[model samples]
Target: RVVGAAKDLPPEGKNYSKRYDSGEDVDRVLELNAGTVERDNINIGDNVVVENL
Candidate 1:
């Protein structure tokens, strides 16, 4: 649910990496998706590829 919300947000820029905004924005994103992210074994500094559906 929360993760879906984050995905729905537009990407920060035109970069291929699909970066999100930083600082508080980044913190908020992580906060929202923390549960599912943790379940998937993803961690800070881990390399991840997010695809748009």
Candidate 2:
């Protein structure tokens, strides 16, 4: 997988979903590349909890 460069993630806020016609997908979360994650010492299958500050 391609490693994503260190970039600012989209801010967390209300997200509008056209498919569901709702904001259900508004967690405002994005996934980093596998390599990027691994570089941060997070291995695959590891349980992780991320909270917005």
Candidate 3:
């Protein structure tokens, strides 16, 4: 799971949902675009972490 303040994720036709009453630390679930990931050459198990936006 991610830490720190949340930022606005890219709006590439993505979707989000909150299936449970998660605490402040854990809120919504983000769904990214598969095509975008593929195009970015991000493998199935790649470490696509970012910091400071």
Best by lDDT: 1
Ranking by lDDT: 1, 2, 3
Residues 1-53 of candidate 3 have per-residue lDDT tens digits of 42222234455355564233324554434455546654675453344565574
> What does candidate 2's lDDT look like per residue over 1-53, in tens digits?
12223344454468844232223334334466546664777553455566883
RMSD in Å for all candidates: 10.3, 9.3, 8.9
> Cα RMSD for candidate 1?
10.3
Q: Tens-digit lDDT track for model 1 on 1-53?
A: 13223434544475676554543334334333436665686555566565672
Selected candidate, larger TM-score, 1 vs 2: 1
**Model 1 bad stretches (over 4 Å):** 1-34
Top of the candidates by TM-score: 1
Question: What does candidate 3 score on TM?
Answer: 0.30
**Which residue pairs in candidate 2 have backbone atoms (N, alpha carbon, C) closer than 3 angstroms, thus clashing?**
none
TM-score of 2: 0.30
How does each model score on lDDT?
0.47, 0.46, 0.44
Tell me the TM-score of model 1.
Answer: 0.32
Per-prediction TM-score to the true structure, in the order listed: 0.32, 0.30, 0.30
lDDT of 3 at 20: 34
Which candidate model has the greater lDDT, 2 or 3?
2
lDDT of 1 at 52: 79
